[model samples]
Target: MASETIPITVEFTGGLEMLFADQRKHSLSVPAKDERGQAVTVGWLVHYLCVEVMKDPRKEMFVLDGHVRPGILVLINDADWELEGEASYALQARDNILFVSTLHGG
Candidate 1:
């Protein structure tokens, strides 16, 4: 069952990478379905990042109200996530998902 999971690339930038072990890139394998037997989507990835991957306790800085916080942009395979169905996008094998924060702090 573990071998059946899909492998994908995840990247963070614009200071967001600082929260993820200070690494800008990550490789992950996720199950095909959720606990409810539903196909995994970008939304699932968000939750997984917080619960499983996040080393920081400031989850709200990554996700707010169950979704990606505003001012952050998500891209899939170099295309905007909104064009790919946003949170509903079904993750594919070897897909590249990037999270870039637009907020700048001095």
Candidate 2:
């Protein structure tokens, strides 16, 4: 059987959207589980955005060492991602995920 998909909204702000085809928000349907049938987490969503959605080559600006780079804040459903287990948080249908960059070049 085909894997189930969850629909979620992803938003980028504080200039991070430039890397994602200059778009600030994306609505996507992603697999509910990994190949091993484990629930899909925010970690997986990050990778998906980098590889599938982002059109800019500056991936390092959004992620570093396989994780969201420092100075970028992740919010899940209007709350800080830290309060929601960060990258380990399982994605839910209609969830809203936002990434905001805090670094500014002078």
Candidate 3:
């Protein structure tokens, strides 16, 4: 196993920038082995993101849109895919994904 850097862009809802300011743009390296000597890959990172998003209570707001339940946008490398397609998107060694909130603010 080898180590490589993966670039990611995390988009936030309007006025929610402060929440993710520290992690707006990051270049994380997937180590060859974890503490238990397990290999890490981009797929693992994507799964982690999905889990994390759902863990936050605010995530409901994105889906509900204050009234209706329209799907939210999770762009991967500038492509919007709210279904399984989003996860299937191949992640390059250096790719960027902008997780934008689809709802508009007044």
lDDT of each: 0.91, 0.93, 0.47
lDDT for predicted candidate 2 compared with the true structure = 0.93
Task: Tell me each candidate's RMSD, in Å, in order.
Answer: 1.5, 1.3, 6.3
Worst ten in a row by lDDT for model 3? 62-71
Question: What TM-score would you give candidate 3 relative to the actual structure?
Answer: 0.48
Write the candidate numbers in order of decreasing TM-score.
2, 1, 3
> What range of 10 consecutive residues in model 2 has the weakest lDDT sum?
97-106
Clashes of each: 0, 0, 0
**Residue lDDT tens for model 1, 1-106:** 3336889999999889988999999999899878777788999999999899999998889999988999989999999999999999999999999999998474
In terms of lDDT, the best-performing candidate is 2
Query: What is the Cα-based lDDT of residue 35 in candidate 3?
Result: 44
Write candidate 2's Cα lDDT for 1-106 as tens digits: 4779999999999989888888899999999997778899999999988898988999999999999999999999999999999999999999999999999553
Q: Which model scores highest in TM-score?
A: 2
For residue 94, give model 3's deviation from the true position in Å.
Answer: 1.6
- Would you list the rank order by lDDT, best first? 2, 1, 3
lDDT of 3: 0.47
